[model samples]
Target: KPNEIVVVPGKVLGIGKLDHPVTVIALDFSSSALRKIKEAGGQVMSFNKALETFKDFKGKSVRLMKQ
Candidate 1:
């Protein structure tokens, strides 16, 4: 979705393409990946930033990956 937030528990690499614009929170990301994401009009940030931004996770459109 356009404004949804997705949390990834690992690093994001530049091996694929993103077709939609969404917010991605990950531990780390490669330079290429960052460029691609930004090119697609998506937002990227670290987990720490996410936590700081959204202290209350409830009632928000956030997606968490299963372990």
Candidate 2:
């Protein structure tokens, strides 16, 4: 699911088109962020790869975590 690619780095460029949305988990935060993640049709997951991170997205769709 390339379209379901999750770009761990927060470096997004407008150089191409991705029919599939990518979830960008960043180490930084920005204002008016809902527009960025929501507009991309992707979610902004924070530290989900960590042990206690699952608690953040418990009610949402999450699976297949890799270390």
Candidate 3:
């Protein structure tokens, strides 16, 4: 799970729960959304960080565009 990364834009709601290192980048965030990211021990990186990290990928199918 070395390359595992999560991306959330806008807001992250309670669809349920997740136990992973998800990096959230949004124009804004809700308190609930922020809590979930921290609780999961994930990082709340800025959009810039997201883009930079994505570029360091090794054949990732997912597309991450700069903001």
Candidate 4:
């Protein structure tokens, strides 16, 4: 979904492309990944900040991607 938030426990790489804009929260991100995400009009943030911002994300769906 466009408004959906994707959280990654590890680092996000730039091997692939994002089709739509979304929010991404991860422990860390590669420099190229950050640039790609921004180019795709997505927002990226740290996991700690995500937790602080989305306190009510308990029922939301989260898919973990393995690198």
Cα-based lDDT at residue 18, candidate 2: 39
Q: Candidate 1 lDDT, tens digit per residue, 1-67?
A: 7778888899888788788788889988899989988888898999889889889888879888643
What residue pairs clash in candidate 3, if any at all?
none
Name the weakest run of 10 consecutive residues (lDDT summed) in model 1.
58-67
Poorest 10 consecutive residues of model 4 by lDDT?
58-67
lDDT values for all models: 0.85, 0.48, 0.60, 0.82
lDDT of residue 35 for candidate 3: 82
Model 4 C-alpha lDDT per residue in residues 1-67, reported as the tens digit of each score: 7657887878888888787777888888899999988888889989888878888788776656565
In Å, residue 36's CA in model 4 sits off its true spot by 0.9
Model 4 CA deviation exceeding 4 Å by range: 58-61
Q: In model 1, which residue pairs have backbone atoms overlapping below 3 Å?
A: none
Candidate 4 displacement at residue 53 in angstroms = 0.9
Task: For residues 1-67, write the lDDT of model 3, one tens digit per residue.
Answer: 3224545555555456757756565556666767876788766766787677666656653334243
* TM-score for each model: 0.81, 0.38, 0.54, 0.81
Best by lDDT: 1
lDDT of 2 by residue, 1-67 (tens): 4324343445333343434455555544454454555666766655555335544554544334232
Candidate 4: which pairs clash? none
What's the alpha carbon RMSD for model 4? Answer: 1.7
